[model samples]
Target: MSVAIPIFKPVSQMQLTPGSTVTIPDVTWEEFESILQELGEKRASRIAYNQGNLEIMVPLPEHEISKDLISDIVKILLKAKGIKYQPFGSTTFKKQGTAGVEADACFYIQNYQQMIGKRRLQPDDPPPDLAIETDVTSKTTLGAYEAIGVPELWIFDSGKLAIYLLKDGKYIKSEQSPYFEDIAITQIIPDTVERSWQVGSFQALEEFANLYLSIIE
Candidate 1:
């Protein structure tokens, strides 16, 4: 039985009101997945649907202090370092109840290009090199990856961060991942930057930006 939890929605501004007569669109799981083909970029919007009859209501991340903060921070540093990555998961969780979590940020190392062949990536492909999550600590998102057997995962609370790596089909707490050593617990979240805004804050990012320019010189 699917239950409708009264959780806050991302596009709450268009709340359904009594006698308002709103048009709620409906689509099948296959159609929903087709969206990614057209959008060309992973969406941060959470969606609804069912899998084997289990109902779900995954929505785009709201004003999550941690997700916003960490995402921007990682993006700035990665860009400066000439690293290529994409933010996947809950920000783009699957709508059909598959581990449709879009992490605040997802990193794919140079080796990731190997997964690309004549066509798109295959199902057996490994997960992103690094997965950065925010807000709730529950395993809903993590569980999804576990089902697909992702190798590494990271989650950030308001001020704290956790990194997990897959081992023998299960995850264990560790300080590092073979993919990216810099994202290890020791360096991922230092005291200097905690809030989502601070990750890409003008002052902090500018400092790194200047350093990047200097390196190029």
Candidate 2:
């Protein structure tokens, strides 16, 4: 007897316009791993897998801009608060026989010490304290993050930022982030990010930093 193998179209043949997405259903975990291997780490696409469904998305320019702005804002706030953090940009996180997701940006805050000098995430290691997603191309599904047990998830869409906190093995919407509860992050971040589109990222970030300094001082 001979084993039959499934054939997949080459990634290069897929015409994914910016802000577009493709979903493949009933993908096995092994096949998902094979697809990841095929895609490689240098690609510009982001992927999410839940159960047997796989999603591939190409972000638009607006999405990239928003992701960068929000990540920068997070770094500024962490620095101003004297908090140590390790940023992981678009790193693929996976759990065996379960789910996988690539965050637009992620950070190890309370667990920063654990991640120091670490190159790849181990199964026993803690997931990121915060994960960010920009929904310019497609809406983010909570299944993967929920399965991965990420503590905090932020989704920027339609000029607004929505925060989700994992509690009791599930996610719940919250107005304040547990890490930055003292500040109105949901409001300030979105406003500043939108302001960046008008005045350029450098000036907007500088202003945000100065404002934050004034508040803490």
lDDT of prediction 2:
0.88
lDDT of 2 at 198: 94
Q: Indicate the worst ten consecutive residues by lDDT in candidate 1.
A: 47-56
Which residue runs does candidate 2 get wrong by more than 4 Å? 1-8, 136-140
Q: After superposing candidate 1 on the true structure, give the runs of residues whose Cα lies further than 4 Å from its correct spot.
A: 1-65, 75-98, 114-126, 179-192, 195-200, 207-217
Give TM per candidate.
0.55, 0.93
Q: Per-residue alpha-carbon lDDT of model 2 for 77-190, expressed as tens digits?
A: 888788899998888888787899999999999899999999887889888999999883333358888888999999998988999999997889999988787899999989
Q: State the lDDT of candidate 1 residue by residue for 109-193, as single tens digits.
A: 6545764441444555556666776544454445665655556777655566667888887889887655445444445454424
The candidate maximizing TM-score is 2
- Worst ten-residue run, lDDT, model 2? 135-144
The models' CA-based lDDT, in order, is 0.51, 0.88
